[model samples]
Target: MDFNFLSPVSDLVLAHNALLSSQALGSKLRIHSKNQGIPDLDAVGIAIIGVLENRNDVNYIGEEFNLNEIRKSFYGLFPGSWSSVVADLGDIEKGERVEDTYFALKSIVSALLKLNIIPVIIGGTQDLTYATYRAYDDVIPMVNIVNVDCKFDMGDSSKPMKNNSFVGKIILDEPYNLFNYATIGYQTYFNSQEEIDLMDQLYFESYRLGEVSNDISLVEPAVRDANIVSIDLNSVKGSEVSLNQKFSPNGLDGKEICAIARYAGISNKVTSLGIYEYKPSKDDEMTAMLVSQMLWYFIEGVNLRVRDDDFADENSYQKFITLVDSQELIFYKSNKTGRWWIEIPFLADVNNKLKRHTLLSCTHQDYIDACSNIIPERWYKAFRKNSV
Candidate 1:
């Protein structure tokens, strides 16, 4: 396979196995190199692709960009009880133009997805998520995006796109493939009032940094329902990262972000994940270690995935019907995972991209609210969004 867009990892990094008396990930991974060519996708479950493009990062004023620290930190970690094969597809160097880089990333990610290989992207700028989302435009008719960040990143779509404004581009672009957009760990101070208002008006979801930090489990349902998940490292507090530019004074902590990544990985619907906005400094060991652990948790979650998509089987789920304000709401609980989902019915005359009815991931609390004659916010939003 000729991947014109990719540049293999340096032999120095691949050959750096000096550490002794330890089982490291470098020993297990099938890495892209001058001699190895490309790894067999059929035998791989996840592929790590690094994008060294940071022109859009708000803090990056120059041309320097790297993910070498991340590779060194990640490759040194020991593997868990994981049976899935992983490959490091090397880095996509910054092209002459930013658009060229986007095109390469889109092509690579699309190809990997077709092979049922999840691409774990470590990126220089969060805006690369726009390219990741575009890769699925033709492959899937509709997609749900989950962004773990401190800001909404929905800048003025009318202006030139940047790291902070790419979500707006995704919304305004052609095909209109976005079904739902959800944000986790967003700080109220970072986003403008207009952006916050827009999220509510569009019937999209936004969870505050306080809310998710207080209850990390709240992110699971949002991530579980998403097809693509993007995490901006700037969402992490400054104390956790060695690079101060990419850190925040009050955002998600290290543990919370890793837990969120695991939630994303456990979701059967999620196909691609990108971690961006990392700024490597001279002392980047701590930052790289955190990123490595986050990746470890995500892989752990993927290995623990249960096939509970089949709700038709009575043996796999328990059904419950509740009447909320005279409207019927059907809920299903997965026997395998104890997860809950509510069905949102579509009107027959309505032209919707979704089917006649769709199952929206919910919590047991939502089911209880329905029993008390209260419609869950999730159901109401899905009901309205499904309308043409």
Candidate 2:
């Protein structure tokens, strides 16, 4: 339970919290403060941590940033009927080297995960996601990550790690713990053709901005199957965020991004959520308010979570069998939540990563497609990955 790497939330934020309404979220938090030190984490379901390191940002110029405004905005909002306890553990200041910061963040995230406490990280750059992924090396045998971003961020791993290319490092680095990586709201124009081809070849998933914008529910299945969810603020449209934070003229709007965050929160397997690429400006109230609302929605989603994924009891779900071409596709619908899942047959002969029969999350549309003699693309890719 050593959290020496963390610094207490600033006195200014603490003073601000004192003046907030008794029903405000800030008033109910177990805060780590200069006067009280780190708060006890007993029974805490979520911990908020900030990482102040952006040296690896591709556009870095020795600039500095802080999460104080985001915290202020979050504290001012009234809580929903949330059953989960939240604590703000404050920030991890930039270390002497970028790698040092990564090590500290990885350590804190790993400790939180072991305690079954989901860490909601507010970060300086998206590359910090690499550290968070590494934290799962010992905690989980395999991991699935869902990135809400406009670009693939799979820069060349052969070169040094940058915020844009940290995914490449995750793919190439040791432990090989990553089972699946999916990007939602990716802009094709922002990515090169090779990256797109690489995603297909590796069986990784990518959803374009247009497709997801047209139907935000498309994000549910992908996020439902994830272990970690990372969001880059740049995924949001220029009009939705501050000028300094904007990276694209076209991207997810505030409502779309918050919905995605809530989907991440609702996922039972998702243990960590990081919102990165925050840049401060004089007029950052808009962006700060947006980030705070996203956090609020995520917490609300957590409060409403239902354990409907368990299929051990046949009575809990309805089973459907359909034939697509010569292959039999098995679909299960949860009676409680109406969520759909397609089964991936386990292969006994080959070295199977899953080691047993697995159900991949899907939508009702996928079932309709199967009924129409069409195979769901996700099922096909997952099948191929399993066989390999």
Each candidate's number of clashing pairs is 0, 0
- Which residue window of length 10 is worst by lDDT in model 2? 240-249
Q: Give me the overall lDDT of model 2.
A: 0.94
Task: Report every candidate's CA lDDT.
Answer: 0.88, 0.94
Candidate 1: which stretches are off by over 4 Å?
18-22
TM-score of each: 0.97, 0.99
Residue pairs clashing, model 1: none
Best by lDDT: 2
Candidate 1 per-residue C-alpha lDDT over 79-128 given as tens digits, one digit per residue, 9 for 90 to 100: 88998899999999999988999999999999888888999999989999
**Which residue pairs overlap in candidate 2's backbone?**
none
